[model samples]
Target: MNVAAVLSCALLLAIWGLPWSDWLGHFPAHMIRHMGLVAVVAPLIVLGFPRLADPLALSPLAGAVLEFLVVWGFHLPVLHEAAMASSVVFIIEQALFLIVGLVVWAGCLRTGGLAGAGGLLLTSMHMTLLGALLTLSPRVIYALDHAGALQEQQLGGMLMLAIGTPIYLIAGLWLVARSLEDTKDEMA
Candidate 1:
């Protein structure tokens, strides 16, 4: 847990540092940095938190679904355009991303192994699809600059695919391993 806390703090520093830097705050960096918060930092916070029972009370799959909606819905061109159009909307979008991300990770961490793993697998697949969509799109989806948007989108997608996808899969596999251990204990 202490290790988790340390990792969380490190991720936060990275997240906060990006916006201050002109070079790092751009398209692919911004998106990729946010993913670090969502997929890694948030999970570490959850696993490190002193009280785990609160989030564990909810259904893991429900959290996963909510995460899917929040992440996918917010990232879409229409919604992202709205966020970009206003500072308030952008703040809200980012807030929801962090909050929902925490909930989903907590749920996956605390729920029964099988349910968590199953939900995680589904989530990974959904994220994979989203990444593919972004990566394969020929035109720039966002109105941010329109020129470099395609390359940026593809980079963000590649980040999701290369980094985000593996986190979910590894977490799911870990849950599966835990499940097997518990089953063995019960059988014995």
Candidate 2:
């Protein structure tokens, strides 16, 4: 692997080692770490080891749906609470985040056209919607243990918007432009 790729892998491990709850409170920290995994780390890994993605045969649409389900399912009140309550559950949750992230990124990177763009765009939309809900909610949606203060919950949502939304949206748009260029090139 290239130095950059090795560094990114190390960074992923380092992020998990951080005491996110102590640094940014529970909810915001979790949100930031989650975003970092799926948005930053996952893409870096895909870019680093493109061949590693070959084993995954998921379509862009299916990859998006899988990612969406994993994210939302883990964020559900019951599951969220369990994760917060137990180290095992928390580890499982985090592992899944990384795994699904790799899958989605691999699929998108492999299929850099309308299919990739659409999947990424769809992910961006759902991420935005989820973030908005968390930010705008009057009452805390998740358990108090993980959600922390209401303000903290809102901040977490804001973090998601700040991190996940732009990354996915920009990636999608870039893929669309790439697709157009490829088509133009083929016609020439």
Candidate 3:
């Protein structure tokens, strides 16, 4: 499982974090790429290899906060545009996405394992609200290399809602079920 998770992350980064990212240039593509890495890859790796927690001594709350700030900070038009023009910010952005993902999962695993329902829920809600804001906006929000800025932003919003939200919800519920099972076993 750990190897599979690592491979999955490697494949995703190769597609999104490398030259293809420059080739794609559209905001939604970038947003989906980042979301896919954090929401999908991070949880898979952490759950597969819990030993990863030792290196990143992070709390669930701090992890969530850091993830939230990094995600939103990057979405800001100025910074987003800067990343588009420069390679350095793009690299930094991708690194932060991976690190924040690991930190969030580590936070959950360290404190209560799957019993960290609140942290997971917080992550879900954060993605939902961000997506909703983008999707429901009356005007175009981003300056992209492509023509359909509004459409791209809307798609990005949908990806967050459709993809990110479900992943966190499932993970949280899975954790809750595991904790309950463990409790019953102990009682028995």
Candidate 4:
């Protein structure tokens, strides 16, 4: 609804277009897009459209679990392969990412206390674990339709670790601080 949220929507559109749009062909690029969707763009959209998720009435814990399943399930070899092979599947996968991401972010924003921090911290932990798994795997986990599969996969993992971790960690910490501040103010 605000300027920042509007700009975030534009950024989301830009990410899906142009040179960064080869998600099916480049593993690292795909990871970048994934991180942008779940971490960056989703939060902003929730800010702009807070009521969009109000109807769901999801708790932070429920939202986190739903998001975790959607993200990790799509990364499974079979599902990943299917998405890579078909445009329709890819679209479906991306749409789910955006939707679940919106849900998680909305839950966090609406809760905005220790509970929200916990949800975000949990998400950060799982994302780190997945990134580490992909980064340290001896062989390629997902069969890519391009060259340098192993290297690209590793880069993708690194990208997730680099991008997703810090954003979630910082946001979680920010929420914790805000919660404490509110409590202190109430006590005063």
| True-vs-predicted CA distance for residue 170, candidate 2, Å | 0.6
RMSD per candidate (Å) reads 2.1, 1.7, 2.6, 1.8
lDDT of 4 by residue, 13-50 (tens): 87677466354347777787788899988888877766
lDDT (0-100) at residue 8 of candidate 2? 68
Candidate 1 local lDDT, 1-188, one digit each (tens): 48988888888887756563266334566566657767888788887763752544357788788889998898877888787688798788877877777877777777859998887888788888988888898887778674666787788788778877999899999999999999999999
Clashing pairs in 1: none
What value does the lDDT take at residue 161 in candidate 2?
98
User: Best by TM-score, which number?
Assistant: 2
Question: For candidate 2, what is the total of clashing residue pairs?
Answer: 0
Model 4 / residue 21 / CA error / Å? 5.8
Stretch of 10 with least lDDT, candidate 1: 18-27
**What is candidate 2's lDDT per residue for 1-188, written digit by digit as tens?**
78658966887877788788888888998898889988888888888776775666377888889989999998898998899899999999988988888888888878879999998899899889989999999988877754348989999999999999999999999999999999999999
Every candidate's lDDT: 0.77, 0.87, 0.77, 0.85
Best candidate per lDDT, number?
Answer: 2
Residue-level error in angstroms, candidate 3, position 13: 4.1
60 in model 1: Cα distance from truth in Å?
A: 1.2
Q: Assess the local accuracy of residue 171 in candidate 1 as a C-alpha lDDT between 0 and 100.
A: 92
Q: Deviation in angstroms for 71 in model 3? A: 0.8
Better of 1 and 4 by TM-score: 4
- Give the candidates in order of lDDT, highest first: 2, 4, 1, 3
